[model samples]
Target: MLEWLAGGAEAFIGVFNEGGKVFIAFVTGILPTLIVLLTAVYAIIELVGEQRVHKVARYAAGNVFTRYTILPLLAVFFLTNPMAYTFGVFLEEKHKPAFYDSAVSFVHPITGLFPHANPGELFVWLGVAAGITKLVENGTAPFSLAKLALFYFVVGLVVILLKGIVTEWITKIIARREGVTL
Candidate 1:
């Protein structure tokens, strides 16, 4: 029992050390980027009053193309957390539950596709593209880096569209059932 307990404690310490290293690495890598992005976003919001921003958001929400395609594409191509914060603020200010639901659905997948607006994302995307090309290369492999990026882009767009549409529909149904206007 003593030997077993000692071995378990040793293994636990090793795992904890490794986990701490990974946590430190992730924080060091992402903290600066997050700080800069958040600062810029907040600065812009301050410059362009909340009311004006909400006006723009309302306009975007009214348009299907802008709401689904353009916004999601921008969010994915840009940084994720910053866009998420901006959208969250917009939702809060606008007080439109449907818009909030739809935007959340649209933003998350794009964030997943392109986590950071860094070269690392591009490299990872390229590697995945190469792997996919190798796997599917029967005749001439049509999986160029651009094509792979585009495919993921389209996938993100499709996910946003589906989620936004479904969420909006469900929200409306629930609102109606509760005798409330969405």
Candidate 2:
């Protein structure tokens, strides 16, 4: 069956009103936390000094654990996805591709626990969790959004770590044998 539309100025007005509600919700629910988080990241970066960050990046580039895990994790969380790629500039030619693999893979996984990490892709987390949330509200499921977020966060980290390691190893082998086509 189909429903009828208001079919006039009223329908247009109604759509705008609903859009306004979403904008209001976003401003109230996510904006403050995002502002504070971004501010803190910038403040910490400023206080720590770019020179120190570069030194750490150079140091981190040599070790697999630091190279793939700490560096990527920090860069992604510190600068957030696209901007995080800037950190790769500090790495050697061989390490840059591997570091990028780790950094790029982390953007979505991080949104669960830190929505601000990929705020533009918040729907990735929320869309999946929405069904469970409805079930919980209806008392049909035992899960909550906090639990789900935490679960996703932990799993995401694990996946990122594994992906980073494997990709780095593969990249090394490929570059050595095939001239960095990978």
Candidate 3:
């Protein structure tokens, strides 16, 4: 029993050692890129100024169409990973954005689908959609870029719209019940 336990422990340690190397390599590869991206984002924010950022947020959140559709789409497509943190800071400094605006901006498929702001994610998604289309069509047809784009657009739109609407409604309700103005 002692030998068996020792063997198992040795195996586990060996596995962990190899896994740790891989983890370290991944972090080393990703860290520089992340630092550069974050630095650029921060520098741009500073150059743009707090007031301009607040104005953009207010404009984006001015209406349901802009709030639910345009804002989230732009956040995901353009801002990528930094949108949430940037907006959080802006909200803290300006206190102008609504809960829904921040919520929708943060809760998008950008990071999951488009890590590092790479457009290659769209191609990957298109490939997946093509595979599904092939399965649906029994390998009779290829999926078009237009179809893939439409599918991506519709899915993104629905997610942002639902999240924004629900967040706004719930926030308003909670604030009203607590006798607080949002």
Candidate 4:
């Protein structure tokens, strides 16, 4: 009974220590990389000029396939996750949801190559790659994580297209049935 009480205090202290370590690790390890990457991308966009960017956005807005695949993939991957939704401002109100869906779907697939894309869930991608590496070393599986990462990106884009198209059609159908225009 007393030992249980002692254990509770120890667990609480351990949690506090782990929280401090996580904070330090993130500040030192992740923050600088994130800053550099974000700065570099925005700089390139500036160099590319507003007209070129707007032209691409317009082209993507006009097509279901481009709207779902290239638009979200570029925005989500380059702009990072949150502002990727901000990029949806170019899209119509109806396409916004599908845009969000596609953006979110692309995050996980890109993680195979860019783990910083979903830094909080770092272990999810790292764990899978590590497991595959171990298996290949043991001859239990014959796979290259690098190749898998590339395939993951391709499949993710295809899935985003399929999901976006299906959701966009369903949304249009519902709107039409409700006597609304999209």
Kindly report the root-mean-square deviation of model 4 from the true structure over all alpha carbons: 3.4
RMSD of each: 6.9, 3.4, 7.3, 3.4
For each candidate in the order shown, give its overall lDDT on alpha carbons: 0.56, 0.78, 0.57, 0.81
By summed lDDT, the worst window of 10 consecutive residues in model 4 runs over 114-123
Which candidate number has the best lDDT? 4
Worst 10 residues of 1 by lDDT: 88-97
TM-scores of the models, in the order given: 0.56, 0.80, 0.55, 0.75
Error of 1 at 67 (Å): 3.5
Error of 3 at 140 (Å): 17
- The list of candidate 2 runs beyond 4 A from truth reads 1-17, 179-182
Write model 3 residue lDDT over 104-177, tens digit each, in one string. 44433443333455433334543465476676678554565455556665776677676666766776777779
Query: Which tens-of-lDDT digit does each residue in 79-154 have in candidate 4?
Result: 6766667678889989987888888888888878765566656567766886998988999876689988999999
Which stretches of model 4 miss by more than 4 angstroms? Answer: 1-35
lDDT of 2 by residue, 119-153 (tens): 77776776777788899889998778888888876
| Decoy 1 TM-score against native | 0.56
Best by TM-score: 2
> Residue by residue across 29-148, what tens digits does model 1's lDDT show?
655665576567567668987677667655665565566555544433443433543553433222344444544554434432443543334335444655777766755665554566
For candidate 4, give the lDDT of residue 33: 75
Position 128, candidate 3: lDDT: 65
